[model samples]
Target: MANKKPLILVTNDDGITAPGIRALISVMKDIGNVVVVAPDSPQSAMGHAITINDTLYCDPVKMTEDADHKEYSCSGTPADCVKLATQEILHRKPDLCVSGVNHGSNSSINVIYSGTMSAAVEAGVEGIPAIGFSLLDYSLEADFEPCKKYIKAITEHVLDKGLPKGVVLNVNLPKLKEKEIKGIKVCRQAKAHWVEDFDKRKSPQGRDYYWLTGEFINEDKGEDTDEWALSNGYVSVVPVQFDLTAHHFIQDLNSWELND
Candidate 1:
């Protein structure tokens, strides 16, 4: 008897040709059949945005013609790619949908603005087990070798155990040497945010325009947070839920009187 292979869907916000997605595709190939439908260009910080205002494009492409996977380039957001993969690309519902291997961190508050996580969340809405992986290193040429093995292990675990409905994993790997990696930790998102700074610069027209810039501020010192785990050389896996309702606060709001 042979083991049943899982069908995997791969995507990234950093475009179809990015090294991040390539690394992810290579790792997934070892686990199951991979079908990639990724953005044609970098769509970082796009959040859960979908392309509804214009026509979308998706062309079938062979990322690596080896005996493992098939790929496609999508002219839309990360969320768009996931929808296309589910509807037109894959023959049936995928066993798993993994997004990113993002070039930069999607930790803490940044997860709300990440195109990488959007793809995974989109899959989660469709009842597919999903995960989004990120590396703390933001440079395009940053070393990804340290993440390969850990990625494989995590993917295998999710494929075997399966994920909770309406929930998905957001995994972040620290930028450390392989030997320096402590271990993996299931954690919560830290209370952190970017202190926004708008860099004012004059263009050729002498009009000032702003380029957004900011620094990450980690206010939470909890040991169980994703920030703590990554800082201490551990892979952080945070279970993310899509329901945006603040259930605990709803009752309190109803108790207040309205001036209207």
Candidate 2:
């Protein structure tokens, strides 16, 4: 909180070259010194995977002709990228770590499988405040201009007020024009899930294969949830915790007749 600009680690699941991350970097640069260490290729839905057996190769690269920020492309998952950045790349702990501006929504139950959120969670595990951002549009050419201003505001807020330990933010922007977008909304994650099915098929070698297919179903009608906020034209900001403990069920589990 001194005169020096904060160091911000920028990363994403949608590869280093993805437009989403590029847009994210533009916003982060305005707030702090940025160091980008992201996947060299798309690693969406990869969860919190880390590279153990295989070799991780990370090298600095220039993304644009006039680029001034430190950028590195890594051959690893989003989680691995954070680990490498903290352990090997950056000389000091970053003031904050930010992921995504992802090509699609990472709201509701999708968080479990999101590489974007996983990176932020990984940062949280390392005692760094973090946030993961996403947009409703899944297209590579999704218009990101409308979301940049909100992203800047949210990032500035997080920088001002550090997040709680073990907690990070999951932000989702609706695909709407800048003027049509409602203001930011702090909400809880919706109770939603995918009713998934695989499409069976045959390859050219006559081998069987299956492609993943699913429909997202939102069972909760609560208006205070992330899904509802996004549906109603606001940017959804959900505070997420990396802890997976089922603390509420511990008391009930103790009542089980185990000695009988």
Give the winner by TM-score: 2
TM-score of each: 0.96, 0.98
Q: Best candidate per lDDT, number? A: 2
Location of the lowest summed lDDT over 10 successive residues in candidate 1: 61-70
Pairs clashing in candidate 1? none
Off by over 4 Å in 2: none
lDDT of 2 by residue, 18-117 (tens): 9999999999998999999999999999998999999999999998899988899999999999999999999999999999999999999999999999
lDDT of each: 0.93, 0.96
Q: Cα RMSD to native, each candidate?
A: 1.5, 1.0
